[model samples]
Target: MERVNVVYVLLYDHSEERILMVKNKGMDSSYYTLPGGAVEIGETLEDAAIREVIEETGLSVELDGVLAVSEAFLEQRGHHAIFFTFRGKVVGGKINIMYPEEIEEVTWMNAEEALKYASLSTEGNELVNRNSTIPYVLRGKVIHKN
Candidate 1:
């Protein structure tokens, strides 16, 4: 199976009440997620987070710290994905969808509303809620059935 490394940035506005999110077009439907994407070869995780946020949301951010490290197996896809979520602060740029083909919209949503609509597991939602400066790990397994 292929191993994929992805980075996501959780950016909040000045008030910290709202978070920057992207509505992405999935294979079957659309879903809400934090601004981020796959890490390219030779790129560090932190650089990938900053670059992804800029590419997906048209905003530049300085990551404050790592938030969570999540792992999952995509059985159907024959892949294992490791996701690194970082807490970031916007330093400049306005909200815009640079990659229209993959992203549907870029907007800020209240924390509660974001968690409600986000395509994340219950534990994932809780991790976001914690907002801990110390990083946490969430491991998940894929179940295969006959």
Candidate 2:
């Protein structure tokens, strides 16, 4: 199966009760996902996460460490994706849609309220509830590499 690596950043507000997320029109017309994107060639996962957040949400953040990892078999997209989720703090920048062309909207949501969105990314939902440890690794099914 063709493989791809991506990163997901859980950019929490200083109070630690809110999350930075984006409504990515390109990925799904109806979902809000964490601020992150693919790891480009030569860029570390940490750097990619920071870059993606700034590009997508216009916020500069400092990563704490890996929070969780996940794998998804996107049959429709024909790729097996490995997602590295990082926990980070917003250090700078104001709320703005940096990539308005791609991002439908960006917002700061109460951690609990964000979880209620039916279209929120599954991996994101899972991680929100599993904050007991750092770098929690999630093993996904090979199913179809779908």
Candidate 3:
């Protein structure tokens, strides 16, 4: 199976009340998710997160630290992905959809509101809400084994 590395950035506004998120255009339907994408060859995890956030949301950010690590195995797709979610703060740029093909919208929402859109956002919000420094880990689960 192919192994993929993905990076997501959970950026909070100045008040630390809202999180930056993106609506991704998928094959079946659009879904809300943190600003992120696959890590390219020769790129560090931090760089990938920063680049992805900029590409998807048109914002520059400085990552405070890693928030969570998640993994998933897709047997039918013949791949597994390791996701690195980071806590970040916006430093520059405005909110804009830089890439319209993959991303449908960019917006900020409070943790409670964001929970209705994406489940993964829950982990990040929990850490921020509780002021926890430990990173959460999500073990990989295989849908089917051949």
Q: Candidates' TM-scores?
A: 0.83, 0.78, 0.82
Cα lDDT tens digits, model 1, 1-146, are 89999888888889889988899999999999999989999777888999999999989998877777888898978889998888889999998888899999998999888867654568767766787666433334568899
Query: Relative to the unseen true structure, what is the Cα RMSD of model 1?
Result: 7.9
| Candidate 1, superposed: residue stretches over 4 Å from native | 117-130, 135-146
Question: Which residues of candidate 2, in runs, are more than 4 Å off?
Answer: 116-146
The Cα error of candidate 3 at residue 109, in Å, is 1.4
Total backbone collisions for each predicted model: 0, 3, 0
Order of the predicted models by lDDT, top scorer first: 1, 3, 2
Worst 10 residues of 1 by lDDT: 133-142
Candidate 3 residue-wise lDDT, 1-28, digit = tens = 8999988887777777787889999889
**Cα lDDT over the full model 2:** 0.77
Each model's lDDT comes to 0.84, 0.77, 0.81
Error of 1 at 41 (Å): 0.9
